[model samples]
Target: MTATTRSNEPGKRSSSGRMIARVVWMSIKLLIIPVLCVAALIVGLAIGYVVLGDKPLSDVFDFNTWKHMYDLVFAEGG
Candidate 1:
C-alpha cells in the first residue's frame, strides 16, 4: 500500500504567508479608524458651513478654520 500526497487543495496557506496576510489586514484595519475620523471631520465642517448658511465652501479648507479651532481649544479665559 502506498500513500499519495496532494499539494493542491482549497483552504491551504503557508504559515509565513498567512502571517504576512494577517499583518497586512490588521494594518489596514488599524488605519481605517483615523481615516474615517478625518473624513468625518471634513464632512462635519462642510455641514457646519451649510448650517451657518453664510460661509463660502472654500472656508472649510481654509487656515482660519484651523486657527480658530486652535484658539477655541486653547484660549485663556479673561
Candidate 2:
C-alpha cells in the first residue's frame, strides 16, 4: 500500500476511537448525575438527623423539625 493509504487507515481507526470515547464519557456523565444526587441527599439526611437531636417522635415528622434540623447542621457551630 502507498504511504497515503496507510496513513488514512489510522485516521479512520482514530475517528471510531473518538466516537467510542465520546459515548463512554456521555454514559459516565449520565450515571454520575443520579449518583451525586443520592449522595448529597444521604449526607443531608444524616446531618439533619444529628442536628435534630433530642426531638420527640411526633416532632420528628414535622416540617419545622426538618427546617430546624437543616439549620442546625448547616448553620455556624453546628
Candidate 3:
C-alpha cells in the first residue's frame, strides 16, 4: 500500500490514479455541458430560422439580426 499499488488484475488503475481521472472527468464535464448547450442552441437557431422560418442562413450568424430581434422584444416604445 505504498503511494501506488500494482494489482494482479489487468488494466486496474491505482486508487490515486482513479481519483485523478475522476476529478479530470468532472472538470471536463462541467465545462463541456455549457459549450455543448451553446452549440446546440446555435444549431437549433439555424434550423429554425433558415429551414423552418425560411429566412437567410446568413442571418443566423448576423449581429444586426440579433440586435434587431432584441430591440423588437425589449426596446422602449415610448
Best by TM-score: 1
- 1-78 per-residue lDDT for model 2 (tens digits): 666554665445676789999999999989998999988986666566556655445564578977886898899873
Error of 3 at 58 (Å): 1.8
Better by TM-score, candidate 2 or 1: 1
Candidate 1 vs candidate 3: the lDDT winner is 3
Worst 10 residues of 3 by lDDT: 1-10
Clashes of 1: 0
Could you arrange the candidates by lDDT from highest to lowest? 3, 1, 2
Q: Which candidate achieves the best lDDT against the true structure?
A: 3
Tens-digit lDDT track of model 1 for 1-78: 999986776789778989999999999999999999999998988988867757788877889887998999999998
Error of 3 at 66 (Å): 0.4
Error of 1 at 10 (Å): 4.5
TM-score of each: 0.65, 0.49, 0.63
lDDT of 3 by residue, 13-75 (tens): 789989999999999989998999999999999999998989999989999999999999998
TM-score of 2: 0.49
